[model samples]
Target: MLSEGQRIAGQYTVERYLGRGAFAEVYRVRHRFLGRQAMKVFKHVGSRAAAEELLEEAVLLSRIGHPNIVRVFDAGIAETPGGRSAFFTMEYVPAGNLEQYWAARGDRFTRIGEAVDLLIQICDGLAVAHGERPPIVHRDLTPQNVLVGFDDDGRPRVRVSDFGLAKRTDAFTGLASARGTLAFKSPEALRYRKGDSPAGDVWAVGAIAYLLLTDTLPFHDDSSPVAFFGVPRDAPPPSPQIRNPEVDDELARTVLHALEPNPARRAADAAELARLLRGWRNPETRQ
Candidate 1:
């Protein structure tokens, strides 16, 4: 097997394992011609039909192009090192996922305005995905799947990643086959509710907003780690000000609204949420 720093496909050099999901493994790689990029190699699909499904996801991501979404540049079930596994190449942001970025900060979110700006961009991107003709629901939206990088102004730029479990809301009418981080999951998701719609992604964005402002997750793992894994959550509204009181109330309220137990009460979609953050002013200070 190719280890860290080894080259695969005779052109791309693997930097390291960035992460692994249920269906695949992600690697930080530098393409000889493309430079730095991320490569997601799926485990053998086990059947021709399954392989077609994985390739379809690649096609779905390629067709749904958005600025804040990770761009998939190349994809094929090429035969090379590591055998006949399927893989797709995408842009690699050096900053890694939001979780690592937050942890490196000593569990503190910096530059309130910058963090909000990042969240707004994410909202716009997700909105584009959800607004597709039939709508696309990112069944799994969490810090681990969201990436953060810096802009020319050194501002934070957020990107959504990992679509292995994504689905078309217009066609899917049953409980999501995929689940994300327990704490960031929507209440309906906990209930195995059917329908993969924009609402679940809204709830996820809300959880991320809360995490970016506060170091802790809105849902607590009070039980033993093993037990907690199975324990259902009654997520509470997390106070961003608990760690940094500097967070604006309007911003905090927006986050809380996204996380409300009643999915029906959540923001309609990413666009609505983005509108709330547009020209954001500290509502608490305005009065």
Candidate 2:
């Protein structure tokens, strides 16, 4: 583990530890000249083959450049007495992730309009990835992967992060099989049938919207830590309005539409979903 105050690549000065997952450890660091940043370094050091696999994440981040996506400032191999480790520096989102943002808000649900706007922001980022030549599908789309921050104007901003599970649409079969958190996965993904599609990502968007509105997952399987592990959420979940009466029918309908099990029937893509959210109107507020 890289300790606080450790310097990597002779440029970034480690400020403190941020997070750690099975594959990597993230540190909050300050570049000698670039200010504050988040640095992610692979945990394991072994075969050159393993290093290449881990480097793919940095490559993906470098390729997908969008304001709504986490920006990769630099990437390189760091040499230490132990060995060489691959690392990348990205924008440091101080507000943490969507999951943390939502949890801190207490029992009160985020305003319907605010939640819809946040979802639209997420869709904007997804649209960029889905628009690529071969289309990059983020097999994993959870609140944990959505970073929340503030812009220069001090307004809330969102950026999609963690592309480790992302892959080109054409190669989905080989890479995305049985990936992603079970709760956020589309039914098709759960069934391991064409699991990495724009439609599958759309489903995750719906699940996120549902969670934001109700503070509950669309489907849950208490029998296992993995929600809906083997059980398909064949039945449509009760409307988000059931939990938060403030969730109007228009918003509830949009969310449920995205959760549709049939990929063909869901929103055409993230762009389409964004449009729906943008067009949503509260009839009660009509003039």
Candidate 3:
């Protein structure tokens, strides 16, 4: 069902397979005219109706262009063995993903300076997504979706990927499945038919931070996604200090606030979360 060296839109040729998931297969590709690109051929859009939805996705992405978000160079369909289907050409992130990076170098991020740097980039990315007219929710912020690398200037860059599974505050994703990672899913998301909010993203980001600090995910377990959020009455908090004492009080508290079971108590949105992180970093203000 899958082939190689396939060209999409008669412009980009698949360089190699990058990764695969239930809904999409990402490939490293090069353009005949445009140079290098990461082509994600989404298996989800197999129908004529789904093919038409590309316009909205393109529009949505075009509206939220930020340095921290993955750049969408072009988006359109490439023919599959069956017929015309979906494919999107995006900026190729050379540094791979955050999980692999973090796993390969764990104790280094335990340093407050590096951890703070990574967190700020994530906040900036979330701010861009949440600042949309209707506010967008990533609905998933697991380590796999966050890509890390550096720019020509040697400054670290973190780009959030995979908007296909995301949702906006005012709308539901057209897909019929739950649209988020189980461990990162907020309490409401675990209980309801669908859950999407800026706070949800904040919580998921907090989960990522927790993992980095502790080197283990407390709530992440072998459970149906439904089971995790279904009974949130007794969800327990994981202590980063327990894992790494260097994970100072300020950062731990901020992370905990975002992980609150109730959305009302969570940071107002990604902006609020970013504001807290920024203010916490100011020594004079903290004093």
Q: Give the top-scoring candidate (TM-score).
A: 2
Best by lDDT: 2
Task: Estimate the TM-score of every prediction.
Answer: 0.84, 0.91, 0.89
Each prediction's RMSD over C-alphas, in Å, is 3.7, 3.0, 3.1
- Residue-wise lDDT of candidate 2 within 135-182, one digit each (tens)? 788988999999999889977788999888888876434224547777
lDDT of 3 by residue, 127-246 (tens): 988887577877777889888989999877998887776666764432123467788777767777465678778888888777777777757553854466557424548667777788
TM-score of candidate 3 versus the correct structure, residues matched by position: 0.89
Query: Is 1 or 3 the stronger prediction by TM-score?
Result: 3
lDDT of each: 0.74, 0.82, 0.75
The per-residue C-alpha lDDT of model 3 at residue 68 equals: 87
- Badly placed stretches (over 4 Å) of model 1 are 4-11, 45-49, 80-83, 106-110, 171-178, 222-238, 242-244, 279-287
Worst 10 residues of 2 by lDDT: 222-231
- Candidate 1 backbone collisions, by pair: none
Give candidate 2's total backbone clashes.
Answer: 0
Write out the backbone clash pairs for model 3: none
Model 2, residue pairs in steric clash: none
